[model samples]
Target chain A: MLSRKAQYAFRALTLLVDKYDQGPVLISDIATKKKIPIKFLENILLGLRKADILESKKGKGGGYYIKDHPSKTTVAAIIRIVDGPIALLPCVSLNFYEKCKNCDQRNCGLHEIMESVRDATLGVLENRTLEDLRTGKETLAKKG
Target chain B: MLSRKAQYAFRALTLLVDKYDQGPVLISDIATKKKIPIKFLENILLGLRKADILESKKGKGGGYYIKDHPSKTTVAAIIRIVDGPIALLPCVSLNFYEKCKNCDQRNCGLHEIMESVRDATLGVLENRTLEDLRTGKETLAKKG
Candidate 1:
């Protein structure tokens, strides 16, 4: 399951994506719109800014805005910034590789199974930028 | 990431899968061989047994064995038994469905991306049994 942080990150980023052509959006506005807790959303936005997915202005028109095109910010990148590895098993993770405790990677039973799962998940997440997220929702809603 | 309990369950189950045709194996043997803590492995095995994936005997000449063929017991089933949901998001999960905390499922941005991930993950996980895990390792090894 996605940690609340990852979910909130997705919510915030998608908001920024929708308002890309508009002026910056206030944290409070985003919090109210997304039902994210104000304090928590502030921190999440800060993390996004640090990741270079978001930019902030100071004073009068101060708020957050998309720092890069939504298409350049993949869902996988945001989730990783907030939730660490995309892989279920750390060992199979490309960004967060670690040895599985007590198992030989060469023959660990879960290794191959988890690798396929990781690859499959990456197939979607690494490719689905925030731009695709909007259209993806529309497509699925129509399918229902 | 998989919780520690889920990983331990896989370790224990795969060990049992390897020795299925043989007589029951001691809990101590599995714990020592897999380097799983004794108490934690006990709880994991109990869960798998309750799920009917493992059958255990008591007292003299008693130990644990796979309740069915390893081919019949899938890695996906074990993961779901131990970890609750295979889907990364609650909305996409069939068995453990829940509404997203603050988003409308009909049009949430993360929904479609997460659905694709869940589908891709399930595509591999639902079909790969413990028997395939062993073969998967060899195929991967040969490719390397």
Candidate 2:
């Protein structure tokens, strides 16, 4: 399941993707439009900014905007930034590997099964970009 | 990510599947083999029993055993039972749908994308069974 924090990130990002090239959007506007709590959104946006996925302006009409084109941002990247490993088991994680205290990954049945699940999930998340998501089209990735 | 509880549940279930029809296996043996805390394994086993996935026996030669053939249980069912919904977002969940406070599911871009993700994930999880996991085989469900 997506963490609440990650969900808020996606909600906010989708809004920004919609408003891309239209100048910065106010945090208040995003919070209001997305129905996220203003305070919680503040931290989420700040984290995204630091990750270089978002940029912010201060004072006057300044707010937040995507740093790169929405088309360049994949859901997998955002999920990793906000929610860490995409793999359900740490032992199977590509970027966030951590040996399980109890099981040997080499022979663990669950490890083998979760690896397939991880690949299947990444097939969608890695291929679909914020632009694709914003368009809300059936442009699902063709399996390679 | 899979919760610690769910991870433990999988570890325990895999052991029971291996021992199925071989007579009941002691809780202590499972705990030691899987490296789960005995008290924690006890509760997990009890829950599986209530769910009719496992049956418990008591007395000198008693323990726990899978109630059904391992091949009959899919990974998706286990995850749902132990960790709740497999969908990343509640609004996209088939069995555990909930209205998003901020967005209309019919129009939300993230909702559309997540629906795809949920489908991709279930492609692997809903098809693979405890038996498949036990064999550590690459019998991943081909996209249909």
Candidate 3:
């Protein structure tokens, strides 16, 4: 399962992407729109800003907006920023690789299957940008 | 990530599949072999048994063995049994589906991407079995 934090990140991103041309939106508005707990959302937003996914502006109209263009940002990027590796096995993870204790990757039965899973997930996630998500299409990757 | 319990389940299953032809093995043997805490493993095994994945035999010269043939049991099945749904989003899960609060699934940006992720993961996991893990070979599913 995606952690609550990651789910919140997706929700927040969706709203921000939709309102990208409307200037910064208040944190309270985003929290309320997405129905996320305000305190929790504050932390999530901070992380997103630190990751360079969001830009926070200060002053009277202060709020947040997408720092990265929606076309360039993938859901996988958001997930990794908030939830850590997408792989089930550390050994199979691209960004969070770790040798499994007592594991022989070459001879391990789960390795091949787990690798396929990782590759398959990457195939989907790496291609799904915020723009595509915002439009909610049937996936362009399928046709290509 | 797979939970500690689910990882332990995989480790336990792999070991048992390796020793399948040799007859039932002791829970202690499995725990010691996999370095899983005995008490923790005891609970895990009970769940697997209840799910009909393992057949337990009591008394001397009797222990536990795979109830279902390893070749026929997918890792996906084990994870679902030990860890619940494998889908990243609750709304996309086949067994654990729930409407995302405030979500319009048809227009939700996260829905399509999450569904693709779930489909990709299931595509890989549903095809893998313990026998494939025991000997550690390229899956025939890959060729087909």
- Residue A80, model 2: Cα distance from true site in angstroms: 1.0
TM-score of each: 0.92, 0.91, 0.94
Q: Is candidate 2 or candidate 3 better by TM-score?
A: 3
Q: Tell how far residue B140 is off in model 3, in angstroms.
A: 8.5
Per-residue lDDT tens digits for candidate 1, residues B1-144, read 899888887777777877878978889889999889998899888888899988999888888998887889777888899999989888889889987666677676677677888888888888888776552346553111
lDDT of 3 by residue, B36-124 (tens): 99999999999999999999989998888998778888888999999998999899999899888877887887887788889888987
Predicted structure 2: lDDT: 0.85
Report the poorest 10 consecutive residues by lDDT, candidate 1 chain A: A135-144
Candidate 2: tens digits of C-alpha lDDT, residues A27-117: 9999998789999999999988998899999999899999998888888989999989999888889889998887766667787778888
True-contact fraction in model 3 equals: 0.78
- Considering the two chains of model 3, state its CAPRI-style docking category: medium
Ranking by TM-score: 3, 1, 2
Residues A2-78 of candidate 1: C-alpha lDDT, one tens digit per residue = 88888888888778888887989999999999889999999999998998889999888889998887888888898
lDDT of 3: 0.86
Clashing pairs in 2: none
DockQ: which is higher, 1 or 2?
A: 1
Q: Please report, as a residue range, the 10-residue window in candidate 3 chain B with the lowest summed lDDT.
A: B135-144
Error of 2 at A126 (Å): 0.6
